[model samples]
Target chain A: MSLTIAIPKGRLGTQAIEMLKSAGVGESIDEKSRKLVFKDENRNLNFILLKNSDVITYVENGIADMGISGKDMIMENSADIYERYKMNIGRCKMSVAGIKGKRVFNDDTIIKVATKFPETAKKYFNGKGQKIKIIKLNGSIELAPILGLSDVIVDIVETGNTLKANGLEVFEDMYNISAMIISNKISYKFKRKEIKEIIELIRKEDTE
Target chain B: MNFLNIEDEMKYFQKMFLLRKEIENYLYEEGYLNIEPSIFEGYDEFTGINSRINRKSTVKLLDNNSEILILAPDITTGIVNKFLPRWEYGKKLKIFYYGKTYKHNGIGIKENREMGVEIIGEKNQNTDQYILSTAKQIISRYSNDFLLEIGNSKFLKGIMQSCSFNKEEYDNVMNLLYSKNRQDLKDYLSNLPFKNAMSTLLNILDLEGTFDEIKEQVEGLYLNELMQQGVEELSKIDNYMKNITDKVTYDLSMVSELSYYDGIIFRGYIKGSNKEIIKGGRYDSFTEQYGYKIPAIGFTVELDELIKVLDKEEQR
Candidate 1:
């Protein structure tokens, strides 16, 4: 039986594919193909495309034996999956951004924040000893501060171009974001040798 | 949509009923008596006593004379409030309950559909091992590929006491560690004085290995006296558990969401599934809220999740 590996779709997917290829499992994935499932006949590796956030769910539920996802998604969801390795790709910073001159902390006023990640946002603000209203937005978080929808926006920043374009500024960097390789706890237990070999291959190739 | 028809629903309910019976039978054979209480109780019985019942989770209404009443959110609290007071003897009290627990939040609609045993009046580590061992036995009968991760609340409290951290810093570290965000935990602890010790402690917490490996790592730690005591308690329970089930794992950094658990906490999971199939821990303070100050520990397994895992395995 082949090992089913879930590669998160989007920017991380490209790097994931490269990492897998370097680990001698690349023949399974076709870069240009829109197919979700890719199989390597010789290596018996199955690559499944999944949304970045859903990658942990799939791997945790054992639908996929292994997965690659962002550290942010894992932290937010807090699934009990084994994080095998940090790929250090698609690097970004999850930060709290606000309009240029807004007061983030005012004793008399409550700060309203918007983000796709409400849990992360709430946790970050709560840690700062400030209670803020969390407004959940699916997209265009930059518009939240500009339109007065929120006082701050918590989102991933790669180049700060989107924030600058929307006339927002980075207020605080919560944590750094990077891709991670994770496996089902059971899979790691039962297939340690096989998984460890793959980890070694990827680590060696990445270093080289 | 037709798959959820009356027949399918009946079948699902029948399976659940049988599973409940199996659990009840197992508990009875192990000396647990069936205890059932009224579904309604005084609002203060829940709110003023045990704070675990969030006011929002309770379905509150006025009685005939406008006295506040609440539908019980959990049977354990009802038992503690009503039944335990009548027991004059200090004998081992093993009670099992199965019924609908009304919660306004309704978080466990399907998988969280609650049912199980609560063994009170026993404070020994042996009782803890027995409950865990019995649970493992029942679950193993259904599926063999399961892992029971155990931790101690005392360990977490000890770590906090050993370090000089305010509430915010404590919460942050605990949150980061609970979420298993290794890098964040490392970064946060890096500047601290006992960074290396904290790192090793976190590593030990994340260590998922055989019984010997866990024992070795735990024993190697340079823990403070309080933490060492916690470790010693864990080691005793782990040793006892090894006699019952080989699948038990010791995670030193594991913390519970509930603040009441002052001793040990545990979560059981199968080969897959993002959530714990079963979760329970020792909340010695549960009785303190009622002015009894008794030590207690028990667990409830979401039979629904177990069924789902089995169904998936069958399909596979």
Candidate 2:
């Protein structure tokens, strides 16, 4: 059976494509092109270009056998798919960020948090036994802390420049974020050999 | 998705009814009598014995006495509750049931139609073969291309025993296994004291292949008395399942939280279906919770999920 994999669009996906090129897995992807799906008959692999967040949804529903996503995305969804392999491509950190010289996590005050990952934020606060009201945001989460819309932001921190530019600083680092390969529970079973071979091929390319 | 006309709804019912009738006829000819399970059961009675039941998902109601009642979330447990309370020794019964089980997922409450069969007072290879073959036949009828993935509960329990993990660690390890997250498991195991068990656990977690490979790999594991018992249970029926290697996958890492299952556990999945269409296991230990110990094994075909699959294929 031909294996289908979901990859995020843009830079992270471009990196994945370069890696796949070396591994001899997927076809050449054109991010700018209107085409969303690329099928490599030569390699017997199919690739679906999707929004980074939608990658998990595809794999979770078995629309695709496997998907490439970030740990932040994995931590956000409650979908019961397997986190099969860690690619470590887009390495970052999920942090609790607030305005400089301000305390948010220390006190018992019911703090409001703003993030794209409400589920992930809820789980993090739940682990700390802290009460938090999450204000879900789409973009420019840094503005929430500055605009008094939220006490802090629970989001992925790449270079800390975004927070610095917005006059905010990370209060606590929650998790180390990176790209990962996730598979549907049933798909993992039926396509374990093929999946393993693909992961191994990618690993070989990584080492080289 | 819910805007189907009356004609479409009627046709849906007609197809479902015909499919169920075919299965019921097969059950009757196989000496399995049909039985209807009650819609409501005492919540406290069942929960006191089994903690695995999801409290939030169960539809609970307060009765006139202020006691809690739950809409039957599952059929097997209800059947066991009915039989085990007043069960007699050497009393053999083969029964089949069709019922709607209610579960409240995060989105909304969904009613699932399930057809299941149970055999009580049986504890031998012949009984296992009968149950396995019957399950295979029923699942194959729904989808020609299907796989019945099998695993032994004792296998995982034995591994846990050998590892000597405390409750917290065991739960953490189970979470890792559930997600197939190798990185965290490796990191967690590196700090643990049991070096031997860690390696064995990692190998089992990665175990995946045809039936024979699974058997061979399981045998290669470091086996204690408990682990040996698990292997013995699986080895008995491993030979008969060899021919259908393409349609089966067995591994030790397959873990289910269904605490009632004490032996073989399996799930059936068909092509084009992301979710399992059938699930079952041997629950002799679950029956013991009612204070009567009788060997029993059974499986349920999720009629609603099956209907969805059939409906999709028809459309294509």
Model 2 per-residue lDDT tens digits across residues A177-200: 888888888887778888888888
Per-residue lDDT tens digits for candidate 1, residues A126-159, read: 7678888989989988998898888888899999
Best by lDDT: 2
lDDT score at residue B278, model 1, on the 0-100 scale: 78
User: Highest DockQ among the candidates is held by which one?
Assistant: 2
Where model 2 places Cα greater than 4 Å from the true spot, the runs are B1-3, B45-54, B243-246
Docking class of 2: high
Docking quality (DockQ) of candidate 2: 0.82
lDDT of 1 by residue, B20-69 (tens): 88888888888888877668778986676654335767778899999999
TM-score of chain A of 2: 0.95
Please write out the lDDT profile of model 2 over residues B190-286, one tens digit for every residue: 8889656566788777565565676667666677777677777777767777754458777767777556888888889888888888898888888
Candidate 1 to native Cα RMSD, angstroms: 4.5
